[model samples]
Target: MKDAAKLFAYFFAVVIGGALLAPPLFWTAPHFSAFFAKFDFESFFHRALLICALAFLWPLLRSLRLRSFRDLQLDENRHALRDVVAGILLATVPLFVATIALIGTRIFLLKNAVPWNALGAVLAAAIVVP
Candidate 1:
């Protein structure tokens, strides 16, 4: 088979196998939510599954045998810092503005009783997701 076709076959096989096995494999998987007796925003099982899935694909990617980072245009740009800042602003500014407008217009009420644990989860997500 052609390399591309082989890669596609491997990818599909993994995807299908994962889907078929997901239910029974993860039914009793460890998760952060077990501590609280409630669903935590974070999950150990999810992260593990993601890592496993990515690992399964790594061999296929390695077989591609690309030249350099620059050849794939994956090299760092000189304006990377500026571009990152711009991207963050572009994503967050609208959300911030909309939040402000909603609060000002009283469309969305600010909850005075905030849960500390919820704040911790948000902080965790910010750190881990980035």
Candidate 2:
């Protein structure tokens, strides 16, 4: 019952947080001309929110139990920056490679040349979203 209730609350939080955060995240996402013609803010935001929720859910659960930040197993060395950097790398590299491949294959639906800034923005989103 305790676990069930926690799950329910987490689910509710994800839905609500996703809805609230989606607009800003979608609005700020790098607007690149893609095969799709226009960015779908609604879909993008929802997806981003879901990804973030899944990625952070464990830490969220621990925090909810009133665990100290240090107790979260953030890192043994107590340096969280390294962990965060590692996480960003782990998340972004594959996505970056796949994005390149998709664009190269014309599967990404980019209608125009991908500008460096646009690519940078996408990379930023990729890093930040997870």
Candidate 3:
């Protein structure tokens, strides 16, 4: 029960800390670079919040005595690459199917011009952000 309470406190701290930090980061990021200015502020805010949460996570894990993957009950796997590929497929195949269905039904329309330059960045973010 004591550990549970501490866990809850840590969780709240990370969430609230991230929420508080994200706005300032979001506001300041655009001034640092023209590239940052191009994306939506909301997207930037979310990514900033993610970074802040990750920053808080280290302390939480340390406090919980979780210093390694095995401590967290994630033992090393030999088929790591295969598992990753399978996981990605499991996640994306359904989304792709649904997207194709939506387009087929005319609920979603394909853009006439694709932003080729942004595609790699968008894909990288999609893979990394989650």
Candidate 4:
């Protein structure tokens, strides 16, 4: 049950974050083609993606009772910045690329209808690769 909850949280975060970020990308693509690189969608997409990735900690949270949290110990040398950045890059790149690719393929190839989100391909790759 705990593991299931963790996975559920992860999925929810990823899906929600991706969904929310999609609009800005699509919306701004045309108006700022020349300066698309300088766009400020990061605030939205980065937050969403980080939320999604951080959802992985749900299982760790579930592992502890309220008592565990109370009794938690910390390693003095532990640093979250490196780990967080790495996770963000990993999660962001794959998801953003996969989503964009899938969306593009579906939109351009399938008669301009986004009938199937690119998540299927992303899911398949995620499953197959690992």
Candidate 5:
């Protein structure tokens, strides 16, 4: 029970702390660099939140006594990249197919021209944010 509570507290701190930190980071990023100003709010916010969450990662690992990937049972495997690619495909292929079907069936219409320039960033954020 104590371990579970500790785990829950860690998660709560990371998630809530990230949420609390994101707004200030989002607002101040442009001041630190012009590049940050160019990104739309949603993109910037997602990145900021990810950054904030990652800030807690080292501490979390330390608290769990995980000194290395092997300690966490995540030692590198030769199949790691392949497995990640397969997992991404497994998750996205169905969603892509369903989206295409919806568009074909006129259930979901593309109302605006695709913003090709922003597509990469948007895709990156979609993959990384969650």
Candidate 6:
């Protein structure tokens, strides 16, 4: 990879890492010792995805800047076949699993009450992993 590409990759890795790990501050409880607050589901996931998009897009844009669209031909084929196979398999299998999980979650939530799918866990996993 070119230096610029490598730099962008590093940048992308960092921001994504931060987004994956970091959570913003929350309002504290005024009555119950100031450790809990009234933050809702919307605040949590919205902030989380906002953070992730910021973190991810920062580096992705950096990557775009590293090379103009006209000159982005990165094909390192010497040892890429194995890695390519692994990547494809990983992406495909998880997509299938996620599809099934989404279906099951929908049915279960319809019958009872659940919240896992609302987090976009399956989507994040599918996109990030792929």
- Give the top-scoring candidate (lDDT): 3
Tens-place lDDT per residue, model 6, 19-113, is 55434323332254332344454454445555566657656656556445445667656878898999999999999898789888885244466
**Local lDDT at 112 for model 3:** 100
What is the C-alpha lDDT profile of model 1 across 1-130, one tens digit per residue?
A: 5788868876676666556555543454334444333433234334444555676676665566544455465756899999999999999999999999999999999889889879887886554332
Residue 60 in model 3: lDDT: 75
What's each prediction's TM-score? 0.60, 0.40, 0.59, 0.29, 0.52, 0.26
What residue runs in model 3 are displaced by over 4 Å at the alpha carbon?
34-45, 73-93, 111-113, 120-130
At residue 33, give the lDDT of candidate 1.
Answer: 42
What TM-score, to 2 decimals, does candidate 3 have? 0.59
Backbone clashes counted, model 6: 0
> What is the per-residue lDDT of model 3 for residues 1-130, given as tens digits with 9 covering 90 to 100?
4678878987787667777776776678668765566566567656766776778778777888889877878657999999999999999999999999999999999999999999998886585333
Q: lDDT scores for all predictions? A: 0.63, 0.70, 0.77, 0.61, 0.75, 0.57
Give stretches of model 6 more than 4 Å off.
Answer: 1-36, 66-130
Ordered from best to worst TM-score, the candidate numbers read 1, 3, 5, 2, 4, 6
Clashing residue pairs, candidate 1?
none
Write candidate 4's Cα lDDT for 14-119 as tens digits: 7786667656664665474443444456444654465556664555565544346445675654778888899899989999798789888875343657647786
Worst 10 residues of 3 by lDDT: 33-42
* Candidate 2 TM-score to native: 0.40
Flag regions of model 2 displaced more than 4 Å.
31-37, 63-130
**Weakest 10 consecutive residues of candidate 5 by summed lDDT:** 121-130
- The residue pairs that clash in candidate 5, if any, are none
Q: Judged by lDDT relative to the true structure, which candidate is superior, 4 or 6?
A: 4
Query: What lDDT would candidate 4 get against the real structure?
Result: 0.61
What is model 6's C-alpha RMSD? 10.5
The TM-score, computed over Cα atoms with residue i paired to residue i, of candidate 1 is 0.60
Q: Global lDDT for candidate 5?
A: 0.75
